[model samples]
Target: MEKVKESEAIEIDIPLETSLKKKLQQTPRWETFEPFALSRVPYIIRENNKELYEPKVVSIGPYHRGKESLRAMEEHKPRCLIDFLGRNPEIQIEVYVEEVKKLEARARRCYCETINLNTNEFVEMLLLDGCFILDLFFKVRAREPHTLLDVGWGAKTIIADLLLLENQIPFFVVEKLHAIVTHYEGDRDSLLYLLQPSSVSPDLPAKGNIYHLLHLYYQWFVPGRTSKQRSRRYSGILISTEHSRSNPIVSWLNSRSSRSNKKPYKPMRAIPCATELREAGVIFKRKESPSDVFDITFENGVMEIPMLPIDSIRRIIYMNFAAFERSNSAMEHDLMSYVALMDSLINSNRDVIILQQCGIINNMLLNEEELAVFFNQLGDWSTLDSDKHYFAWLFAEVELYCDSRWHKYRAKLMRDYFNNPWSALSVIAAVILLIFAAVQAVYSMYPYVHH
Candidate 1:
């Protein structure tokens, strides 16, 4: 990482190539580029560190069944991918590789991984440069396209939505993919039918699926509409240390001492999930299945799980979990060493608010405040001004972003009110009446003067 000055904010260059940056720059800007906030978050940059893991194409065959060769490939795929992503400076890449491996592994177990990608880094990338991607999809759609509509906020659904929004393709995500073709294929009377079976010649490649169509509709038709309609379900996981599940932001809430003369961990009694913390409120929920498990959904959207202790959260976020697990729970890889470097960052930070994109929302069963503070005091460096600036920029950026969105919605409402026919018609009628009365008086006066 380039040394950044602590006193002044710096515009960190995108880890992406200059060409990619230029391409994205041409897209429309919704608001002023938040330079200060953007500067604080480390941009994506590839690393040459041999200590970092490299991603490999794991044989997804076990996911496909009857795949022995795939099992061997899978054995090495995750470790390689983690190492590759760890070396990169971009946090998104690190998060992505970790998730992909996890999903693939879960697939091997004959059960689907329940994680949703809508709230993940990939979705964040789409928000950043959706238009550019949409344009590319339009070109592809003109030739041939197959749309994929996802009913829920699943990973594949998100990926499908990303493709559609970036391109002007026709696609839909009904409750079920098969039902759309079987039930609504040819019925024009069906509002859904006009979208389905194309009256266009069978000769022409069928205009793509609902997924692509929806993306184009959102991008071109419903401008400013959400590309991915957020699902109501929470889509993140809570992480904590292994030994003690105490989160740094909740130091005051989860003290060993009792809150209401209630003995600690009273049987059959649930703890208060929401409470006032040092400078903010901490919210949490108890896990029904696991007595020790508690879900903390942060106000910023980062969810903290009490199942793991705070130290674990500190290690997992910075260091790849696979590396740590492989080392017999020892911090052997450079990623863990980097986690050590982040200890100062983790410690100095009094309040940590992880934005929803950080995968804190993966735990679905909680209200908003469980995740206010993540792990605290992993490292010792409160001295470096850069870290302070980094967090300051982050919080400020999020606040400004939210405020701008509110202002935009407010303006839209005002415009709609003024544009209503009844309001416009009343003003026009009043003006017309005044003009007519003035004309009549002028004509009457002219006639009298002539007589």
Candidate 2:
């Protein structure tokens, strides 16, 4: 009986060992996973407005590929591929297919999630999507419109869908297809120029390491500062150790002590709204023909902010840009920081009115209340490090100006006594009457003293 039991145990152990070995071989190496620039919208941001992050007109990537509502656009994709091939009669469809097939592995790594499709399916998707995108650009360049695509709201929504974070393929795939079709090296800037809306200035330089379409759009709009520029523009005051340089250890110790003695970092809070700032003597002006929308400046009690156009399409793009910044660690939070600053500046309709009056906000679609709510919600969705944002210096300067008692008193005096022409005239009249009364009293007293 003992010998029979030992044989059965050995038999069971063999299958178990084999199964364990197979599982280990199948397991992915987590450390080998690179950071993915294209990812789904984070739950924290999407919880409030999931629809905003999702593509409404079309699905460009695997994440939202087969939904029933998005199937209508899928049908048009094949037509786009045919149109693209028509333009490049020299190249065959198989050539495009084989080219995208070669890039399947590289393209898969760009997405955050593991795409469940096999090689054939993945390559087909890339080929169709890539050709579709290039076709749109070609048509736009020629000033011709697709019979189905450029009609009604379809064109606008398609542009919005292309900017969605999850709807992006690796930019290299598009560049590869463009190069093959045109038989010339693809200029990324030229390709990106076709994607921009008529409202966005196409002349802006699109220079950067672009991961996808959304990234290219971000680079055009929010060009980040270089390392040296950031270091110089940093709002924090640096401690000089010139005197302690004689002893290395002493310098190190002194630096350490100074750091330890410094106050703990406090998260940056929102600045006062536009109305409140106006009440505090901070002038608001629209920065005329600003080089960049984010180029806001505060000096001599005047705050010059670039005019921001508020509309449904722009709002969608800004939200996606903020979402991209939130998801990707490599991206600077320039857009998010801008949104936060706008949110802080516009707390209510009154705040919106103040900015609107100064030409800082070009209200196109949303009402004052809706715009206020939009910015407030946007600010809530974004996260910022107080000391590291692009606007940290601007925030500090504005707060410093607002904090001064003289500015507040001056503003209060102006507001309370001289807010309007009538009020100024009343103040002047009251002063004149008081002076006359003083003169009359003095004359009366003078006559009595003489007596």
Leading candidate by TM-score = 2
Pairs in clash, predicted candidate 2: none
Worst 10 residues of 1 by lDDT: 34-43
In candidate 2, what are the lDDT values of residues 293-342, reduced to their tens digit?
97677778888999988788778887788777778876668777788789
Score each candidate by Cα lDDT: 0.29, 0.77
Candidate 2's C-alpha lDDT? Answer: 0.77
Off by over 4 Å in 1: 1-25, 30-54, 58-451
Model 2, C-alpha of 296: deviation from truth (Å) = 0.7
| Model 2 misplacement above 4 A | 1-24, 30-35, 196-203, 227-267, 435-451
Q: What C-alpha lDDT, on a 0 to 100 scale, does residue 184 get in candidate 2? A: 66
Each model's total of backbone clashes = 50, 0
lDDT of 1 by residue, 19-81 (tens): 688978765353432111101011121132211222121111111222453244334334433
- For each of the candidates, the C-alpha root-mean-square deviation to the true structure, in angstroms, is 28.2, 6.5
Q: Cα lDDT for residue 31, model 1?
A: 46
